[model samples]
Target: MIILYNLVLLVMRAGYNIAALFHNKARAFVTGRKDVFTKLGDYFRQNHAKVVWVHCASLGEFEQGRPLIESIKKEYPQTKILLTFFSPSGYEVRKNYDQADFIGYLPWDSAANAERFISIVKPTLAVFVKYEFWHHYAKALKQHQIPLLSVSSIFREEQMFFKPYGGFYRGILKNFSYFFVQNETSLHLLKSIGIDACAVAGDTRFDRVYAIVKQGGEIPVARQFKSDQKTFVVGSCWPEDFEVLTPLINENRIKFIIAPHEITETFMAAMESSLQVKSVRFSQAAGKPLEDYQVLIIDNIGMLSRLYRYGEFAFIGGAYGKGLHNILEAACYGVPIFFGNKDYEKYQEAVDLINRGGAFEVRDYTDLKAKYEMLNSPETFLLACEVTRLYVEENLGATEKIMHYCRTLLA
Candidate 1:
């Protein structure tokens, strides 16, 4: 079965490479590290304890693992960081982030490719962020007696590891030295697979968000919204997400910062048409002063998380789709959160805050209006912000937890 899986992955790699040519992102990977996975085995052979491998499927996972990676770097400054991506989205956006010693793509998870890649990187420890489990890579790491750890792991029922016939991937779970999950539900899900080395680290993201907030929240963007008061930031947005709520946003009761999910021109134009307020485009604002606009459209990427600092509350994007953006990013500043309903299983933090009344979910315009009305009540908004602040203060120590464990292990 494993060999068959390996063969299947091998066939997929060739197809994926061909597929990469059509996608600028995938094309970037081939260009970014022409010899990355190709030279992995050789690199691994040369470096043993000096290397630590961190794998993220894309930018979201990269942010989830950022604090943990920073902690690891601080704890072991001399240890080199080997970061790998399986997607172009993450690689293209953050390929130049200074933390990693090396940034590149992982060849497909075929047996020969996985083994060869592992042999070259020669990671003393491999950290897989979120729930990205590559079967052959898991097996290869275990076969070589390398330590594997999963950080910020959130398990949904649909994942193969939790299915009734998931024993195959459960074997992969056993290779990990630890499973640092986001919540108790994920812990239970892992236990369902008979995987016990788990801890409710409460999402390394809380640590990341907390640090981001305290670290001078959002660099100077050189402009402000034309709001005297009551400004709302709609972050990581999709049109379906704004379908019912755009009317209220256009109602002029509040200001807006709609950072659409896609940076395409079509989406930006559609967003501008949806708003009644004088909507200003972010790209167009490059040469103009931004102080007079009530509605600012952030057409660029990398600014959503930072932009939260300028708002009273921010509606995170992704809930209208399969999932949502990181609520903790806004929550770190005690910013009240509102989102659509779909990312419930993946967003454990959202569920927790919603239950705690720190956040709310909107199904349509009515829900948005209700949440908006509540926000109008300064007392209610303050209470929500209080809940968010307390939640952040209480869970800001995940970095210490991982660091403590690493101290004992690396000693």
Candidate 2:
């Protein structure tokens, strides 16, 4: 199985190398690993502090892992954190994040690479956030007697670990000292596989978002743009989302702020052209009168979370395409969320919000318009706001629970 995994890795590396010629992300993936070990080695040689390693696959997992990361740092102030990312999206955005002591791309998961990585960093504890499970790395951690954990893990029956011919992957699960899963379903799934080192801790993202709510400050631009109007914030939107939302924006007298998932010039231009109302880009709106335009297009990243504060309600994008983006971000502000009716089954929060009357899943423009009208009522809007706020409030404290377990493990 290890041999097969290595072969697969080699093929993937070759494919990435070839793809690098045409694709910028693929190119970064290939280029980022050049002398990765040397960089890690130099850092290790210089810093002899006790290390806690946290691995995340990408941005979503990073968000899931963030509250724990900050808590760990607070409790173990002397311990250095070595944060590793498997994708450019996470690493690129958070490479300069000050919380982690060191940040870098995780070297490809090969036996030798894992062995070398474990030797250099020698983390006292290792945490894998969400779905990342590398066999060789798990094996190395086990061999080194490092306490390994999986946080905010969710499982489905279709996953290989639960499959008939999944012994190899199942072995990887055994390497974890504990699994803090997001739901009871994940706990039951692990139990069926005879994995008892697991518990239901709920999703840490709720904790993260709740923290955002408490600590959230005003974004001047967002505040200026809203300016007492009933504003709808559209976050992480895609082209498909715009297609469904454009007509709604054209018809409504309410203010709109759209932050697209991809902020490429061409994509922004396409979005601007689709909206019939006067729109201003965030970059250009700084000194200008924002109230003159009906739409404010966020052309950059990093402000979407803060932007939700100024919104009366929100439309979370990505459901029309791959998956739904984070509705919890908007929900934290006690706003009713709207999204496309596609691929929402995988997101437990979205499903729960729909059932709890905190969110609406619209199939198209007509459905969106209808839902908007439904929410336009003062009584209905207030009820949905309370429901969303309560949902977020009820789910808090996963971070504290996980941190308690970690303290016990470390003690």
TM-scores, in order shown? 0.84, 0.90
How well is each residue in 146-195 modelled by candidate 1, as lDDT tens digits?
Answer: 88888888887788777778777788788788988877888998887788
Clashes of 1: 7
lDDT of residue 219 for candidate 2: 81
Candidate 1: where are CA atoms >4 Å away?
A: 17-34, 41-49, 217-228, 241-243, 262-275, 278-293, 298-302, 321-323, 342-345
| Winning model by lDDT | 2
Instruction: Score candidate 1 by lDDT.
Output: 0.78
True lDDT of residue 280, candidate 1: 80
